[model samples]
Every structure is written in structure tokens, then in C-alpha cells.
Target: MRPIQNGITDAEVVFTNPQLNQWVAPMNGNSRIRKREGTNQNAGGCRLAVDSAGHKLDHIIFQGGEDVAVSEGKHVIDVTNGYLYGNMMLGRMGLEADEGFCDNVADYGTLSTYAVNTTDIKLLYYWRALYTGINRANLLLRSIDNPDVSISQLERNHVKGQALFLRGYFYFLLVNKFGGVPLLLTPSQSSSNDAMQQPRATTKEIYVQVLSDMEQAAGLVKDIRSVESAGRVNKSAVYGVLARVCLYMAGYPLKDVTKYADAASWAKKVIDLNYHKLASSYRQVFINYAQDLYNAEESILEVEFYGNGTGVYNTTGGAVGIVSGIRYFNTAGSYGYSSGFVRPTQWLYDLYETGDLRRDWAIPPYRYVGEVITN
Candidate 1:
């Protein structure tokens, strides 16, 4: 067994094909890579490159699929155990229990259906890969040195700084999901020798560490050439992540409440940084319908995952569902779908503001798959 690095221990490491990191999911076996350079559209376009000074990243993880040929194309093949869920981001598949799909609901976002199921092995894979990045971050922060390779002093500092930022990043992920896990700052042994099933730390402690890491990352990448080429980490990315972490910490985890102000501040950083911006259209953020590779301005520090790489997957089935509007399907004045799983909830329908584009397209008659449904 390998030693535990970061708060992650030996038992935590599931040694599979390293390729799994690229694409592992319902569509894993056939995933491919689409490499592209990061660019700056905010200014005269410039390429952001992480010079050799910082430690070399595994580069495998960040190489997530960027090609329409790789991601949107149909050639993707499933290689990992067929979990059938897209490892990419959230989606709106179907809820067999607890929650039911509503006709009035927008086209996507169904993760809450399976959100309560702690038994999801796929969830574990997602978390483990996330922590692996943390482990790498820890190792690099200590030093990017390998007896087999040589490097200049300046490059070493650059790499170390990026590691510090990433270490903070991984911890933030763990804390968000688990609600305060042990702060694993250093490498660990198989026994977790000094740290055995360590108790969950306070959310405050995690927040402190996350803040520290972001600040450190900000300083390290301050002078890097371009936003896209800064390798895996950067200043604006840290700020955006910091804003999100602060939002969670200040809210549900710690009840500090004041953090929202800071959250607002951090969010403002990316908005004002001249680096990133919200896309005019919300849907494009998920699917790469555009030709430009880096949705750089809209996406700050996106986790790279190819369509069907080892441990890599996407949201196709998740994307499949019935979407209707008031203009389309309606019996009298109700909403429903041709689909069995998709039925609208009163709350979802009521939540809409008047004149919203989606409301006019409502599917109605309140019909379930096998029976005539009612509001």
C-alpha cells in the first residue's frame, strides 16, 4: 500500500489504471483528450503559461477533454465500471424516489434526486480524485524535487506556490461535502500512524486553512504570464474559489454569516479582474457549443474531465429529459410531460417570475406516463 499524502491515507488510494483519471464513468473506455491553450480576451489576447519554475503537475487531471470532437462528439466510449453518470458536473436526469421531476422545472439540474444516497460509489470516486489533487498539492509545496530531475531555484518557488493553492483547494472540497474533515497538511503513512480515523475538525479550522491557501496562491501566481497558461492554478481562480468557500463557510458550516460580505468581495474580484465574466447565455457554460476552447472568462479554474476517459465521464443521459412550456403542451391549464419521470411541482411553477421565457413554453394537461395527472 502507498503512504497517505495529505489527510488522505493509504486505504483511501484505489490504484486503477492512471488513465482512469482522464475519463472514468458510463463513457470511460472511449474518452479522448483535447488540448488547448488558455487565452486572455479581456486585454490584448495573451497566453497564460506556467513556466517550469513551479513543480510539474501530473498534467493528466487538468488535461480533461476540451474538444467538441472529444466531448460533444459521439465517438466517446465507456471504459470505467458503468456507473452511467457524467463525472463532469451536475445534471437533471430523473429521481426514482424522494423528489420527482416537475414539468414546469427548467431543462436540467436533477442531482438532488440522488443527493441523499450516501452509498454512491461514484461519489467516492469523485471525492478521491479531488483529494488526489490535494495530495499532489501537498507534495509539490514541500518541494517539486525528484532525484531524477534538475530545476532552477525560481521555478521551484513558482511550483511550490501553486501547490499551496491546490492544497487549500482540495481541503475546501472535502470540507464542503463532509462538513469538516481532519486537516491533513502533511503526507501520511499507511497506518495513518499518528492520525487514525481522526475526528472531523471544526468548520472554522477548515475555513482558516482555505483562506490561507488562497492568499498564498494569489501571491505565487501574481506575475505569471497569462491566465490560461498558468498551468493548473492562478490568482483570479484563487479569488473565485475563495469567494465560494467563504460563502459556504460563512453560511451552513460555521454560521458566521459575515462571510457573505467577503464572498461578495471575492466574487467581485473575478468580475472586476478583467479576466472572467458570466456568459450571456447560461446553457453554454456546461456544453461547449462555441468554437473558443477556453471558456476562460466564464469558467474560472474548471476541473478538467474528458467525455469518456478513465474516471472521466459526462452528462448525456443526465441531459435527457422532457422540457415543455405553456405554449406547447396543455390540457385546460396544467403542466406535464410525455415522459414518466418528469412531472412538475407546484413550488417550481410558482417560483417563476412573470414574463420569464421558460414559463410560456410550459407542457401541460398534467399527464403522467400511464395516467392522466392533475395539479
Candidate 2:
């Protein structure tokens, strides 16, 4: 509860802290879980002890619930950033066994199905990261309404809206990849075996929950465009995501064609808001992304990254350039470090007719220093 009141980001709470980080480590490996016998014996940090009447001793950590709500609100940006990038988004799309790949094509070939095996660490990490967001959101929802909390109605609405959006967004990602997963609305008290083995929900039930959360979020999130930070979700972005969810619902598997109407209506709402539009030059969009120039008239959302020349690699630090840029020595001057991990297919190139401005823009012109490489 001290950790919760202090408002650590979901990642820190799950990975950095001593108590929760144990859940991530395996039980029987060389890296055994440290005994909790003396975990809290050393009192370097302050502790918050409240009597039944609700009197707190630690002033630093036990700030009022309003402050906690504000801290929880900040997690929305970090959670969105985590979801927008990472292996789940890039690997899923990039790993297909396509002739476009210069290397590791076989890894992503039919063999790639093993990448999603239940025991796979990377895939499991994706699931955990999403559930971390969901848990934090649930905690926020539960705590925001406490009688001791003193947030204004507007702040309460904003926090609730952001939490709902994150929960819905994460659930949408899960259902798309793994189909129905256990719908855990309450935060798990401990990572017990029983908690880990909850049964799966139906695909329909999952989507219903996602839609309900997002719809409620839309009603509460207002003035998002004026937030002074483009990284934050606004009303337009909520509607945009809702539209995307609806489009997915209308597709195969479920094939509920009625969702097409919902998709169109939500998309029309985004367009009607006039929050974003087509950039004059399609190529400039990537250029703007490289320069971190968000809030372009054409930009709806952009995941951000930062580099500090750290000795260790930070996945969420936005190192995508190391993956998808121009390959073999960065000839194209693209920031993705041009790993050439993914190349363009000739069929993809042929799809565009002459005078199609986006064809060359979308596909890199690979001139690899005197070699005419054919894939």
C-alpha cells in the first residue's frame, strides 16, 4: 500500500520493487527468489503506518489520495508508450516469413509460431506488461472514489477516463493476439498458483468489456486536444481507437458485420472533430517522427523514445531505429539504424502504379553499395 500511495509507475512497481519483482523471477533457476524473511527488516526508506482511524506517519509517501490520483494519471502516458511500441506491436507485424526480410526470415517463417508458445519469455513479457497496466488502472479506479480522497470532480473524471482507456486499450491488444484471456477486473493480491490459472473469457465477452470501457472513457475525456502535450490521449484519440476496435470487430473470426456501422460512426466522429488531417507530404510524416515533432496536423499519435548512451539496452527507451531502418550501413539516412531486417517485396513495389507518390515513400530504395540484391 505504501508503494501504491507513493504512485510508482506500473513498470517500477512490478519490476523494480523488491516484493513484486520476485514474481518475474523463476522459482527453481540459478536466480532463485530471495527469501522474504528480511526483505523489509532494514528500514532505509520511510514507512506509512495508519491506525484504523486513518492517521498516517510518513508524510513523504502518504500524500493525500488526490496526489495519488495525479500520480496515477501520469502513468497513462507511460503505459501508452509501452503498448504502442515493443515486440508485441513490431514483432507481430515484422516477423512474418516474407521475402522482404534480409535476414532471420526463417525465424519468422512458419517456425515463428513457436515465438508465441506459452512458455516463451518474450511473449510472456508482453502479456505481463499489459496486465501490469490493467492492474494499475484497476487500483486507480478503486482508490479514486475513497472517501478520504479529495480530488475535484474534473480531476476525478480525467483519472477515471484515462484508467478506463488504458484497460480497454490493453484488453484490445490481448484479445487480438491471444483471443479470449481471463478478464481480471480486480488487481491480484498475490501471484499465487490459483491467481495465475484463471480461466479464459470468450472473445465476445472480451470485446464487450473493451467496448464498454472505451465508451465510458469517451464520455469522461474532454479537452484532450488542449492538454498541451500530444503524448496524452484526447477525445479524438479515444474515438480513433474505438473506431479501430470496431473495425477489428467487423473483421473475420467474429465477422459481426453490424460493427461496420459502429466503425464508420466512430471514425466519422474523429474526422468531424478536425483534430488531425492528411499531411501535405506523406514522406514528411516519417521525417517528423524522426525529429520527434509531434502535433503535426496529420499526426494522431506518436510513441516517443529517448537515448542517453546508456551501457545497457532499454527496450521502452525507443530503440526502434536499431531494428527497421535502412539496412547495411544506413545508406538511406533513416534513423532505424537501417538494420535491413525487413526489406521491401517486389510484389509490394509492383502494387503501386506510376505517379503514386507514396510507393517509393513507403518502401526504401535499397542501393547497397554496388550489389543488386534480389530477394
Candidate 3:
């Protein structure tokens, strides 16, 4: 099979590199049976393709759980690092810096700093990216039971569980952002206007579906201990997210007070599992994130971003530190560079008590002047 190109017409190739090409086998009628390749691999780097025949089906189905996991993994990063990060910057939680007021970050900052309408390009991108994620999950869920797919029942459940969780998670993000959106559960099979247009579901209705998807997912996915990487979602992650979802449902829009109890129940389930605990130090948590270390005990789920934009998989790296981290500049490479697009507000900093270690790590009191650190 030939390596797919960027902006390929027939396939949704998220990432294409030499490393991905080694394991991401293309699906054709001749080779319908395939096994997932590699353990603890970067699933975000996997690519998905649609053959000429399958392209007409309106969705691409992978041959194995690994393929689904790989494709979904990229979506996970897009949602967390892309959409969710934008949400943080837009909200009062993070103040957008002047540097962020230009270029790509400006698209998002404009929505917050100025009066913007639904027609904003950034909003459109966010909507499309999220729905794309939901559609991938939907396709996986629809294809898991096909006999043509060679995955075992166990493998099927694993992927299905992740898909359900992801679909629900995508919808959760959507409902939080847009209040109500057109809810599409099945994979798109037609390009007709009738098939394309969907009425917006009610906020309560969306929450109900989210709850169903996550609750079912919690049962199907593997335990956190069994998962090799924090990048992959497991039972604990599902439970934790479910708890947060319940809390949202119990709040302003829905005002479903009963969900508070549900939230507590889900939160308690994670505690009962005994797999996760607070790290030794508050700084270690963020340090683990910066260093790309997996400490499942504290970090339940994370979007894995690696490399330095130099290797074959140049797209593997993310802007987590560069955008929100401290600003520094030096040509010697002794001090890393950060645009510092988002900074903590004084109110947020003051929320921390004098002795709080998180105060310093989260919102440092110092700045870098050339090669020297200064306060």
C-alpha cells in the first residue's frame, strides 16, 4: 500500500510518518483480517485510510482494535490540547497575553476579547473538529460487531468502550460550548441535504445521552492498572470524567440536583479502585506532564505529545508548555522559549494560600531576563 498524502481526498490521514507506516496496514477486501500492532505505542501517530470502495460508505472502518485505538488517540489529543485548551484561554481561568492576540491563537482570543458571532472561523473549526471526533467514534462503534472485522470479542469490547467514552466526551465538550448541538449518533452514509441537516437536541437530552455513553463505557474499558500508558483512557478515567459530567448536569442549565449524588458515586468508584492517589508533591504532577512521564497514580488520563518537530514525526509534539508555560528567550538554547499565550490572573494566584506550593509552580513569581532569572 502506498503512503497517503496530506489533504488526501479519499482518506482521513491524520498523521503519516515512517514509524506509522510500519504498523498502519491499509484495509482491503483481500486482507480483511488483521491484528493490532505494537504495545504502548503512540496511538496518536496512527493513520486511517479509506479505499475507493469504502469511501462511498461515508465512513472508514478499521480492521482491528489497534487501528481504531490509533485513530481515536489522535482525536483525543485534538480535543484536549486543541479545543479544550482554547476553551481554557477563552474562559476567566486564563488571561490571554498580547503575544496570543496575533496569528493562530488570535483566532480564539478574538472570540473572547471582542464581540464575535457564530460565524467566527475558529468556532467553525472547533465545531468541525469535535464532530469529526464524534463521527470516528460512531464509525468504530458501528463496525465493531461486523464479522468481517477479525478482532476478538475482548478486543471489540476494548475499542467499543473507548469509542463510547470518546463520543460522549466529544458531545460533552460540544454541549458545554454551544449549549445544544445537532446530535448525530450513526456514521454518515449519505451526502444529501436531508442526511446532513440535524435539529439541535435539548441540553437535558444531550446530557442523558452523555451519561448513557459514559456509564456503558465505564464497564467496557480496561482498568487503569492494565493500561500501559496514561494517553489511553481506562476505567478510572471514565469514572472521573463521568463524575465531572454529573456535576455539570447538577449545575445551572440542567439543575438536576439528583446528579450531585451520581457525581459523588462516580467519584467514590475511582477512590474505591485504589489505583490512583495524590503524588508525593504538587510540583511532581506538572513536572511529570512536562517530562512526558506517566504517573497513573495521579495523572489518570493525558494527551501524549512527544518529539521536538525535528524527526520523521514532526507533528507529534504539542504546544502545551510553549503556550501556557513561562516566557523565556535565549539563542544559546540554554533556556527554552515560550510564547506564554495564557497567564494566570492575579485573582487565581491570590486564591492560593501563602504556603501553597502549587502557587509558585502554577503561577511563578519570577521571570527570565535574557539568560538570567529575575523577579
Candidate 4:
């Protein structure tokens, strides 16, 4: 008989630590898989990870999820069959045989079909994940708000700031990806699906809401002198992401050029804080960290992932991973996920003018991955 003293679940009991109730509700809520057709299916969010195979299909099939196709019919689309057609495969048309995926237009020429992949759940995943963190922080703030708990005003404010910033961060992430997402706050204390699946909000409206929440968060955390401020949503992190939101607004469908000054100002604030810098050795930012992620420096803010040790998701993606050779062909000795599958385009490789250094480090070509280039 496990303790359910505060309505904590049995599984929670197993996961609880004597030192910390790490797996309990709010701070750590329940996310057991609900059986589907005798098999369990986790929802598409934090507890639910985006499937890469799905993205691979999305990249290959559709006209382009967040990108466009360069070649005409009977190319990779026709060659791969209509399997390489339709957003049903996750904007299957999104694949271009190059890096930065949709970052450029030149790589649009000779994209051969690689296996299915997925990463763009990005907006939904970050929103869901960080909001989960916010919920945890909120639960702590609210429950500990009694005479019994006696949390100090500053302590309360700290958690409140964390929660508020996380909420802001989550919303910013969502609006970027899905265009607009239903904002969900106030953790449900009740066991119900009653609150899920709310209608979407407008991009302008969500952007406004995000700004409002961030203002509250920025005001709440007065000084940024602590460990939490460094890693998590400290004032600087908030400003950094705020810049991103503004930049995105200016660039894409929004095309609000007026937002540029705000973006530049936010970037300036990050510089003013002296919290981080544009690493002296660019490779050091990614290289040292790939060996042991804790050693990484460039990541001003990052969601830490533990080695599931299941050998799943066991590939370096953003900087190190290769997609083409490994994820699709299951090519042996691939260094990283990006190393395995995603290819760096010749055009991108051309961006460097003689000795810029960035172009070489980034578009280093799949042929350079150690001694594995057998062809």
C-alpha cells in the first residue's frame, strides 16, 4: 500500500524521492500512456515526442511544410512515387536535400528522397513541455501559499517569475510554429479531459498575450543574480526569445517591419546584460558540448535531455548529427543524427568567402565524417 496522503498516484510513489517529490503532480504530473487498440499512445507534446519517420514523410511528400520544392515533376516526387507528395506526410513537400532545411532556396535542386523524419512538432512540443514546467512551478507557488508552507515573499516571487516567464516562453514558441495555439493556464486539479482541445487564437492576439505575460515576468524578477537566472528563463533569456518573436513577426507571414526595432533592442539588452557572448571559438560552442552536453557554452538556454540509454534519440542532430546516411540508409559509423541523414548543400557551402570559418565548420560535407566515407 503506497502512500496517497495527498492524492498522489501509486506510480508517483515509485518515482518519488525521499529528498524530493520529483514525480508528484504539478511539479511533475502524471503522463501514463492510455491504451489505444490495446497499445498505448502518448499525445503529441512533451510526454509525446514527434516521430522522425513522420517528419521524413512530411519532408518528402508534401509541397513543403515550411519550405518549397525546386525541381519539377518526375524528380524525387515522381521518382519516389506520390509517396513523396502531400502534406499528409508532414508537409512531405518540406524536404530539400540540404541543411537549414528551409533556410535557403538554392538546395532545392537535387533533393533525393531520404526516409521520413520529424522535428517541426517544435512549436507544439516546446509549448507543451515548458508549460508543463510552468504548471509545476505554478502548482508549487499556489500550494505553498498557505500559513502551513510559509514560503517567503521573495521565494514566492521567484517561482512566480519562473512560472510567468515559462508561460510566456511557451506561448512564444507555440505562436511561432502553429501560427496560433489555444493558451492553457491554471493546471487542472480535476481528473478530466474537460479542459483540453480549446479553440485556436489569432496570431496577433497570441502575440499580444505573450507580450503581456512576459511583461509580468520581467517585472517580477527584479535582479538576475542566481543559478536559475543563468540556465532557465532569467531576464536575459526572456529578452533573447522576445527578440526572436519580434524577428519572426517581421520576417514571415506577418511582415510587420515595425517590429524590427524591438527585435534589435531586445538583442541589445542581451548584449548589455553581459550574461553571454558570441563565443570566441565558434566550434567550441558545439564541439566541446557534443562530447558531454554539460560542457556546452553556446546554448544560452536549453532543455536538458538525459540519456534515455535506450539507444533511442541517441544522435547529435543540430550541430553534429547527419540525417541522410544514418537515419535513412542506416549507414554505419555515422557521427550524429545530422551526420547520419541531413546533407549540407553545396550552395550553403559556397556562402563562405575564402576564410569566414563558419561556412567550413557548418557545411563540412558528409564526406568528412571521420574515416566512414567509403565511396
Candidate 5:
């Protein structure tokens, strides 16, 4: 299968009609191409196009979806460059400060100082990442059902289910952050279409769509045990996310008290699955993240990062431990380097009771000094 040359351009030009021979120009200002007339020629054309487009669907789900979900990569500028770090890191920083657990350093004081606004570059990055994921999912869903494409019914359901879940999850993130956003469910065939400029859907309407997509996906997707990796969405992950969504609906903004029962019901479904359980220790959860180990029993879903910042796979390294771990500057030492941009506050320290194992691990009382820990 051929790789996608341009994501948006390729997605817009995918045609399934077997009767028209119209010339089409991609939205990216690429050279126009003419489709030859005849049924056989159109079928051959669809097969060729579907092969390349199918590869693109897989690439976006695995690579682009991961970047949007976890916010990895080195270039902290453009979201398409695999530098969607603002999504998770910025949210974490803001939440830590808001919850009175930590304070951001002056050097990285955007969220902590309440300087963030609609025009913030970080917000723009995250917005672009989420929409890009949605667009990719839309393209996949629209193209997967072509009669010329060779795929089994079971495989088609699996792929379609994943696309629906990703689209719903992206919408869920957008609604939580921006309250309301334009909902574009279908693939955009042209930039000139008037329908492309959709008005923002209501908060409750967006949640309803999210619930529908996820509920349908829960039935179509593979079970947690059937999936090969925890990174891929499974029945358990959908159920857990459904629970979270219901709880959100039950809180401020929507404040739909009826959703509380739904949230409990979804949570119970996850528990009744008998597939997942809490880890032996809370510290072990973070340890597994730092070591790139998969604890499927505990982590229902995860964003996967691979390799160090070197060679062809350099861009796959994550900043999980480096940005938030204990302060350290020795590159050759076992502790490695940490910026320690956010530090725990005294209020957070005093909140923890005696003999709390999580207190020391979450808010470390020590620092790394030349390969040694010092209190």
C-alpha cells in the first residue's frame, strides 16, 4: 500500500463513484488529475485509490492518534510535526495548580500564571491536533465501505468501530476544553462547501453524539483480552471512558443529575468485565510508565512511545519522567535529566496523612545529586 502524500488533500480527493470521469484538483493546490471513463476503469481506479487510502487510515490511527492522545515528540511548535505536547502537559500543569497540588516555575508560567487565553499558541496546537484526529477518523469511516475495497465483514467492523471511537474521543476532548465546538462528522470533500462552516453544537448535543458513537463502538470493538496491545481501544476502555463522560455530564455546565446513575452503571460494567484490576502499588503504576512496560490489568488504555532520542525512531521518545521527575542535571548519571518545571506545594504536602506511601512517591522529598539521592 502506498503512503499518504498529503493527509487532508488525499482525504478530500477519495472518490467512490464508478460512473463519473470528472477531473478533480486536491485542496492542497496539487496538480489536477482526470479520471478515465468506463465501469472497469472506474473500478480499477477505486481499487488503486482505496489501497493507498487504506494505508493512510492505519497510519493515522496508530501514529497520529498516539501523538494526539499523549502529546509526544521534540518539536513543540506544530501539532502535525508530532509535537502535540501541549494537550497533556499543559492540562496537567493547569490542573495541578488549580487543585493546589503544585506550582509551575516562572520560566513556564503560562497556565500557572493564568496568562492563557483563546489566542494562546498552546491552545491552538491542541485544537489543531484534536481536529486533525477527527478529520482522519472521518476520512477512514467514509472510505472503508467502498465496494471495491477488499476487506472481510469482521475486519470492516473492527476498523469502523475504531474510527468511530476515535472521532467520539476527539469530540469529547474538544467539548471539555472549549465547551462547544463545530461538529463535523462527515469527510470534507471540498473547502468551498457551505456546510463546512458549521455552527457550534450545544454541550448536551455533543455529549449525546459522544455517547451514541461510543456505545456503538463498544459493541463492535474487540474485547480487552482480544486486543494485542493496550494502546488500542477495547471494550473496557470504552466503558471506562463512558463512565468518565457520564460523570462530566453530571457535573458543572451540563449538570445533568440523571447521568450519575449512568456513570455508575458504566463503571459497574468495567468492574464486571473481570479483566482489569488495580496494581499492587500506586508507585508501580508510574514505574511501569517510566520503564515503558505494559500493565494491561491496570492500564486499560495508554499512549505508546518507543526508543530514545536517537536514530530513525528519535521522535518517539516521551517527556513523562524528564519533565516531571525529581530535579537532576547529570546526563551520565542513572537518574538522567529532569527540568522539574512543576513542584509540589506545602499545602499538598500537609494534605497527605502519616504512613501514606503515595505522598513520598508523588511529591518526592529528595533530589538527585550526581547519581545520588539527597534529602
Candidate 6:
């Protein structure tokens, strides 16, 4: 796993592969990496190279393919997986059933005060899930100087931008949910007591880090659609997320009114990019999604899902559709299992303007219609 000490010289790591075939082969397996630095770009740009520190960035990037490629491309493969895992954690946190037909016994218990009991183990589980994402991103950043894996400055910048975005995003979630939290910059490579006993940082400090990371990422990432894989984060998504983060920082607990202008500025940048536009028909978006067709032009960022006939919880499986999909019975063309746990409040349904397409699209006429009906 450690590339620099494996009796491999930096020059051998970078230029020894005359054909540069070793690097391209592993990168080609990962769509995003292939697109970023594939053979087509410079006849073999994906070849791994080392930095001045005798570290091999290529070795770090190669650590993650399916069966694992040569020593060089393994690490790059798992980076995408880390982002996917973080998305799932975000999805889980927003699953509180109080929103409407969804009913979770635990949600009911916690809704009254908008608080969780300290004794509730689920809180710890959720916290750890988010931190796991943070740790993965941190480790990637930590290894940027591994003289064993050879990577160019451009490649390093792109990877660092992504790592920062993910780390900031995880911290944003932590601060919003639990207030002040320990701000661990270095990766916890071991389970030593020193790693576990860090003190909490103020919410302001966390917000500063979040803004700093997002701001840097916005400048470093390329627009995603131009690349082969839209699944990965891009400059536009970074701006969009920055807008939302600014909004969060501006509201309620933080009350940093000045950030209102910052939020607006970031959002305007996304709009100015014109990379995505509103779909003419909202329902078409979901229809396309169910059919495994994604509209990158209209959806700047999307969390992808693959549905099986039966619902299962796994990295590749998504239950949000089932959790919030039409409950009680299945709809022939629907994307979910109709778990019937979450429902919309009638007040919310009625609040929409009569001609607004989203109102009905959001809360359909049929409240529950599969072998059962409840008022």
C-alpha cells in the first residue's frame, strides 16, 4: 500500500513504462479517471508519475479497481466509492418521517421536541457514518505527497479539490446536525486514544473550513458534463453546493446575514454557467431516471440509483424512492416499492398554486391505493 518504500524509484515510477500502458490500463477501468487523464488526451497521460518527495501519486490513484490493477491505479478507484457512500449517509439523515404519510416509530418519538435522546445509539451510528466519509477524503488528501505514486500538478490539484469538497461537505452536515464537533484535519490511520479524544471546534471554525474548502474546489474542478462521467463532482456542482452552504450559514443558529449576499453570488455563478436548465416537465425527469436515462444538461448534479424488483439496502441499492414512493401498493411505472411509510401533509398539497405542475407531481391525487385505503 505504501508506494515510496517498495524499492521503487520515482523515475522508474513515472517514466519506466515507455508505452505508459500500465497507467492507462487501470485508469481506463474507472470512467471518471479515464476521462480525466486517459490515453486520448496526450497519448498516455494516465501513466503514473512521482513528485519531488519521492512519492508516487500514481500508486495512490491505482489502489481501487475491481480485482485491483497493478500497484499504481488501486487508490484512485475507491475515491468514487467514498463519494457514493457519503451521498448515502446524507440520504439517511433526511429520512425523518415527520414530513408527511411516512411514519417511523422513532421519528414519532423524536419529532415533538426536534431532539434525540442522548441514550439513542442511532445518533452515534449516524455520526460515525458521516465521519467515515470525512476520514476517507482526508486520507486521500494526506497521501498527496506519497513519493511512490507519480501524479502531475494538474492531477494533484483536481484530486485535492475533490477531497476538500467532500471533507467540507461532511463537516457541514456534522455542524448542522450536531452543532460544534471535533475538527480533525489529519486522517486517523490508527485507533489510538489520541485519535479518539480530540476536542470540539466552534461552529464558526467549522464553517470557516467549509467555506474555504468549497471556495477552493470551485476554482479547481472542471465542469462535469464536459467530462465522461457526470456522476463525479464538478465546478458547477461545487458552486451550487457552496450556495446552499452559505444559505445555511446565514440562517438561524449562525445568523451571519452578510452570507446572504455570498449565497446569492454563488447561486448566480451556477446560473451564469448555464450548464443546466429547468426541465419543461418535472415528471419527465423522473420518467427518464426510472429508465436509466439521465439528462445532464438539465440536472447539474444527481444521486443515481438502480432499482431491483425488491428493495434492498446496499451501496448500489437505493431505498429513498421506496421509502417516499407511492405507498400501500405498487404503481406499474413507478420507480419504488411503495413502502407507504412517508406521506405529504394535506396542507402542503393544498398550498400549491392551481396551475403549478410541481404541486401534483409532488403529492399525487392518490394518497394510498394498493389493496388498502386510509384517511
Q: Mark the regions of model 2 whose C-alpha exceeds 4 Å error after superposition.
A: 1-84, 87-91, 94-102, 105-116, 189-196, 311-317, 328-338, 367-375
lDDT for position 243 in model 3: 95
Question: What lDDT does candidate 5 reach at residue 87?
Answer: 22
**Which tens-of-lDDT digit does each residue in 257-304 have in candidate 4?**
999999999889878876565656877654644444232124455432
Q: Which ten residues in a row have the lowest lDDT in candidate 1?
A: 1-10
Model 4, residue 364: displacement in angstroms?
2.8
Report the Cα lDDT for candidate 5: 0.55
Select the stronger candidate by TM-score from 1 and 4. 4
**TM-score, each model?**
0.54, 0.72, 0.74, 0.57, 0.72, 0.70
Displacement of the residue 115 alpha carbon in candidate 4, Å = 13
Per-residue lDDT over 1-375 for candidate 1, one digit per residue giving the tens place of the 0 to 100 score: 000001111001111334322221111111122321122111111111112213332311111222110111111112112122222222223332233453422322334344446565555555555554554445334334443223334443445555676678767766766667667775432212223366767878887998998787677664322435212356676787788888887776488788889999888877777766676655444334223244555656543322211111111112122222112222222221223335556566677697565443342444333345689
Ranking of candidates on TM-score, top first:
3, 2, 5, 6, 4, 1
Tens digit of per-residue lDDT, candidate 5, span 1-375? 000111111122233332211212122122111111112111111111322342222212121221122111111111122324312353454455634433544534566676777666655656666666666566667766665445455555665676677778878887887788888887553211322367878888889989999998888777778664455567888899999999999998999999999999999999999989998999987786566455678877654332233322121233444446677655554444555556666777888899998998888888777644579
Error of 4 at 125 (Å): 7.2
lDDT of each: 0.42, 0.52, 0.56, 0.41, 0.55, 0.53
1-375: candidate 3 lDDT, tens digit per residue: 101111101112322224322212122111111122223233232234433343333333443344343333223223433344323322321244322232234545565466557667666656666676676566556656656554456656766787788889878988887788788888654212222388878998889999999999888887877664455678988999999999999998999999999999999999999888898898887676556455657866654433233322222233344455566543234334555555565666678897987888877767665755579
Model 4 poorest 10 in a row by lDDT = 71-80
Which residue pairs in model 2 clash with each other? Answer: 321-336, 325-338, 326-338, 327-338
RMSD of 1: 12.2
Better of 3 and 4 by lDDT: 3
lDDT string, candidate 6, 257-310, tens digits: 999999999999988886777767888876665565556677655433232333
Which is better, 1 or 3, measured by TM-score?
3
Candidate 2 residue lDDT tens string, 1-375? 000011112111122234433323111111111111111121121111122212211111223444333332123223322223532233545444453443444533322443445555445556666776676566556555545545567656765786788788889988888788888787553422332589989999999999999999888775546543334456776888899999999996789999999999998998888667786688777676555455434655433334222322222133343344444443333222334355566776788898898876667776344355799
**Alpha-carbon lDDT of model 3:** 0.56
